[model samples]
Target: MPSTPEVNFFQEYWIDAWQRSILTLDVLRERGNAYVERSARTAPHVLSFAFEVVRDGRTLPRPVNYALVRIVPPQGTAIDSAKPPFVVVDPRAGHGPGIGGMKQESEVGVAVAAGHACYFIGFLSQPVPGQTIEDVCAAEAAFIEEVAGRHREAQGKPVIVANCQAGWQIMMMAAIRPDIVGPILLAGSPLSYWAGVRGRNPMRYLGGMLGGTWLTALAGDMGNGTFDGANLVANFESLNPANTYWEKPYQLYSKVDTEASRFLDFETWWGHPVLLNAGEMQWIADNLFVGNKLTSGEIRTSSGVRVDLRNIRSPIIVLCSWGDNITPPQQALGWITDLYGHEDEIVANGQTIVYTLHQTIGHLGIFVSGKIASREHAEFASCMEMIDLVPPGLYEAVIEEVNEGTERPDLVHGKYLMTLEARTLDNIRALGVNSDEDNQRFATVARVSEINQGLYRTIVQPAVQASASDRSAEMLREFHPNRLRFASFSDQNPLMGPVKGLAEQVRANRQPVSPDNPLLSLERAASAWISTCWEGYRQVRDAATEAIFLGTYGSPLLQSMVGLGTHHAPTERRVARDLIREADEAQLRIQLQQRFEVGGLPQAVLRALVYVRMVQRSVDERSFAMLQAIRDMQPLNDRMSLPELKACLKEQFLLLRLDEERAVRAIPRLLPESEAARRAGFEALLEMLGARGALPDEAARRLARVESLFGMNAQPAKVAHA
Candidate 1:
């Protein structure tokens, strides 16, 4: 009794359903083949761009697993030798390298498109024998030096882009060898390991739940001398089981025709795991993860040099996301709290730290999303020069898109304007959910870690090492769950042989269901329900884990056993030594006095301008660009280098902070005696301040000071026309 159209629709739906089943099986076979092929390759970098090796670590006395490669740009894009070279260091956490340049719209790609030479630091699957993290650091430093030597005519030091784990390693390099590196960009890196909110971040309590670094050592011992990276990969997957187990596969299955290439491309890198030496694994767990000593300036190298973050003089740009549970904004920005008590201390230490927060991007999205690459990474690359020119202080780098038909045009080639606004320590602290009770709990964990590590080394380490063997280690790595999952479905399995032939036949007579089909809609709804069920399970599991962790670690008896009192005390703040503080202040005071009356018209004008900016606490690309234009004009042209000009600006700023009244009064002494020169300087300062919009309150005060020093009346001159 059904109509003709209804009968035809049912027939088409059945045919489409049969085709989709066959297609899904084929896609799976192809994915298995790709995995097997990738696993068989040696030294697989997985970079979308072609590269040539520049330096090999195997040539060194204490060789590492890494190598430096120069990227070969595609057609229509050529490297400019005059621009600063960019070096991207991908995280070697659990996967092989090249995530930074895995796609066309990535960090390395953006840098290359901007006409800069690109380089990538990657490693092999196996680490060199007896190679420690310190050795790896040294190798990276040597590689950077080699890159610098090749580009002697470049404008500045090499700009380093480090992601996640590489972020902390690069910071350590910058602290030890600040002279070789330029501005460093840290994306999704957690410098402060113990920082997190109570209910939101469950990973922070992982160490406390396991009792200490003993479990890490036990895992390493079981692996015979190298830790299996598959285990680390499994731990990361456990954080988002819904995505790992349900949504990821279901999405691929629903759109198998379109999603095959993307899925395989990502899986190639995800499936290939690497290894870490036992010593390197143990050091990271003890010193950085459980011990929490890097920011506190307690970590030391083999050569007896203290690894203090204050030693790094390069400008640091921290890029994090609110949705990144792995490395939240608190973990990314909490190092400021650990190093300095107040914002003034950062300025006094001569550090320039700029941070930007993405609203809802996830951890991997921060580095791999093409949309993020074209916007945030593009804006960052365009503003590196201006970032270096900013005065020593804490700032928040704000990037906003340019609206259509707006008078305020894009400063760079992109549609975004990057602004650096001064911020205080309070602003940084507001990014975290800081609780005194939480701090004491983490401090208690640190003490327990020390005691446990000592006990393990004395009693447990010897027996484990004596029992471990190379054959058993290889067997353990081979049988890891992550590896077995891939191997189980690959072409090596005899059962998959018929799947390939059936998939080929389905592709030859393909029939895809219409997106609006009723059956297809029902299928998608069913998939969604499955995903939701997995998510609910994950939430319940996480809540129970957190409750258990707090109950076991927060016990009074356990606290006392670890030498912590029944009522735990907050950790003591670390401050700079008095001798260093006094010495730095003395040097700054001497420079301020010496340069108080130095220079002619140009120098006087710049000194006044810098003082105004210091008071207003706002600096952006538009203002700095205007300043550059003014610098290119007569009298200031070719007079001083950028370094010298930056030095002058810093001296004036320090002088203003030391004594504002005296510094403002001395402005006239540096200016020319002629009234015409004084008026012209005042007009230039006003122009720079009003470039963006209306003057802020501090800028108004500064404008009044400038007018008073020039002996102008209460009614200011018409500088807007100038």
Candidate 2:
């Protein structure tokens, strides 16, 4: 005897629930089919571009599991051969290759659209029989050399984009062979592994908690000499249980029709895990992770050349996100503290390090998010020339959208302008969560790792090796939780056989809930509740893990047992030899003392500009681009290469640092003695400084000094819009 309204409501709820169930089934069926199809492909590189294999690592003397491919842009998007080639090296941390270019709006896509010859460094799913990380690094260097050779007409060296794990490898390569790399962009990569804040960045503590690199060795051996990547993917999923277990599925269910494609696309990469060799895995864990040797300048290749960050002379652009838990901004940027004493050390070493921190993008989003690719990646690619032209210093590159009413809107074709602001070591430290106690704990972990690794090698490894066989390893890999989940829902499962047919019927007679439907709202509420539960559990578990780690490792008795003292010592900064060489020092002093009065008008203008930049300690993309434009237009055009220009700028900077008053007064003498020439030079300098419409008080004052020195009329510093 229910009322008519109640009966109607019950009927609507039932219909809505039934339709949602049908759509969920259909989505699952599609996912299963995509998984099966992806599995069958075997050598699946999920890239959108048509590519040719340029360099096969297998052909090298020491074979590796990687290859270099040249991407052929689609018709009507002809590449400018004269433009520097762009090479992207995808990370092989856990997933298969090509995530960087799977979509139209991606790293590779942005580079190709900008008319650069594009290349990709991707690896096979299975590692070659005896490949090592060093072999892979060597193979990558060879690939870069080939690309550089092919692009001889380009203005500079080939630009490289290294994502995640690949970022560290690229840095190592640049350190070993600076001649092979131009401007390097490291996205979502961890350079300083031992760097992180307390209670956050739990992954950094896992190695110490687990008793160190022995566990990594055991896992590799358990995989039959090849480490399975599914475990790594599982670890990543575990970091965000709410999204992995609940929100992801609920999102697809809510918008099953529209979200299916994106879900499948991402899962295709996430589900398809790759493999790493035992040696490669162990090397990464021991040297890079546990030893923390790369930033310390202690990692040496098999050929005996020590890989040092200071050896990398190429300009580096580090793009990290504050929201990334896998590699937090601290881990991404803390190497500056470990490697350099101050910003002056960076300049003396002749390195340009530009970092951009996104407020909320996660680790994966740094490389795959379309919005990020369109804005950050596009701006970085467009500004490579200007970035190279920037003097050696630390900078933070800021990307902002162009205002329609802004000056020189025509020059702003990409809807965004990137500005480089000078930064100090204090700024880098602000981005980090560095504590001396944490460093000591990590150092203790490193020492413990060596002891445990030795014990395992002598006692456990032989037994493990004797018992482990290819068959058993294959069985272990097949039964992994990540793999089994996919397998269970795939065509291999008998219960899924009828899903395709039923899904087709559901699609044909599809019905969806209205946004205002009470049932739909309730479903969303339930889903959110479930997600919250998972998140709560994850937080508690992470807290327990962290507490246990600190309690066990923080104990003084354990530290004493490991021969570690509790005293915290500051990390020593190693300066490059070239920075302090006698020849360079003598030559710099000579240039500084040589009367600047003998230089030409162009030289004087450039010197004055550098002086202003040094004093203000800031330069933006608009200003840098205007300077380049001006340099190209006059008697300065084709007069000096970028290196020569950079050299001149550095010399002037050093001279200004030595004697500011003398440097400022010498500007007029460097300019033509003619009053008209001095006036024109002053006007041009003002135009460059005022390109963005307003100047800071320091810049305005500096300009006044220059006008007075040149005997020009005191005029307000302003310029017409381009």
Model 1: how far residue 721 lies from native, Å: 11
Which segments of model 2 are wrong by more than 4 Å?
A: 1-3, 567-599, 635-643, 672-680, 708-722
- Kindly list the per-residue Cα lDDT of model 2 for residues 623-693, writing each as its tens digit: 76677677677664446666566667766776676678887787766777787877777788877777666
Would you list the C-alpha lDDT of every candidate in the order shown? Answer: 0.81, 0.82
C-alpha TM-scores of all predictions:
0.93, 0.93
Candidate 1 per-residue C-alpha lDDT over 1-722 given as tens digits, one digit per residue, 9 for 90 to 100: 76687667677778887776777766766666766776677687679998999999888877998999999998899787867789999998889888999999999999999888989999998888899988988999998999999988776789899999999999998888988998899999988988877677788888887778888888898888888888779878888888999888877777888988888778778887899998898899888887778888888889998888887877899999999988989889999888888888788878889999999999988988899899888888878867877778899998987776533464334678888989988997787755665656666777787788789889998999899999989888878888877776777888877887888888888878777777777878888898899888988888887788777766678768777665556565353454765598678777777766676666667767777666557777777767666666746455555556666677777777878777778877887788877777777777666666566566667767777877666558443321
The residue pairs in collision within model 1 are none
| Candidate No. with top lDDT | 2
Weakest 10 consecutive residues of candidate 1 by summed lDDT: 713-722
Clashing pairs in 2: none
